[model samples]
Target: MQRFPFRFAPAYRLPALLFGVTPGTARVEVDDTELRARFGPWSLRTPLTNVASVERTGGFQFLKTAGPAHLSFADHGVTFATNGDDAVCVCFHEPVRVLDPTGRLRHPGATFTVADPPALLAALEDLEER
Candidate 1:
């Protein structure tokens, strides 16, 4: 498994801990067949084939992505954010379960504040080539 860790901003480090999200526990792992993500109490797992696309993004709004996993009211997308800086947005071909406890609600995409967006993107891109 290839693991890509999340980046915790200096300010976000403490706040993220409130949700049990620390540098040690938060990361995204990818393999030949599947992808897995862990953000303390939250997680997102799906087949690598489900990934539709990946793009680098940054400059997150604090209120929208401060701690834990955030759900967008407008887009219904889930965000597992740690910092407001560099990150990658992973879009899925089919919506997947994320925030809804009952597993009724699903998200079209997920954004993560990984330490190295390029590496993450490259990894995802490689999956597409295969």
Candidate 2:
């Protein structure tokens, strides 16, 4: 698997915690057939074909409007972060269950932020084209 890592500044610690996200570090992993996100102690993985759309968004603004899907650190499919830098929002063809630290399905979908918006967006676009 290939991984792209990002560390949030932890500026939104309180808000992140409110959304159940610890807000520190995160990574996006992609392979021939699937894509996954690992945030703090939570993770979400699904088939590459499951992705319906990928778009850039205001890191903090998006988080404010994004709804919380679980109590294990994800809001509106996004993994929380301290700042909105390099944020990429993803939509899936269907809900992909999110697993909290305990490995329980607390939410679904794969919306989150990465360190590099352009790189992540490009990768997703490539996947969609394929």
Which 10 consecutive positions of candidate 1 have the poorest summed lDDT? 60-69
Report how far off residue 55 is in candidate 1 (Å). 0.5
For model 1, name the residue pairs that clash. none
lDDT digits (tens) for residues 48-110 of candidate 1: 999999999889988778878999888898999999988899999998887887889999999
Per candidate, the number of residue pairs that clash is 0, 6
Q: lDDT, candidate 2, residue 99?
A: 46
Q: What's model 2's TM-score?
A: 0.68
- lDDT of model 2 at position 83: 60
Candidate 2 global lDDT: 0.62
lDDT of each: 0.90, 0.62
Tell me each candidate's RMSD, in Å, in order. Answer: 0.9, 5.0
- Those runs of model 2 whose alpha carbons end farther than 4 Å from true positions after fitting are 10-25, 59-76, 99-109
TM-score of each: 0.96, 0.68
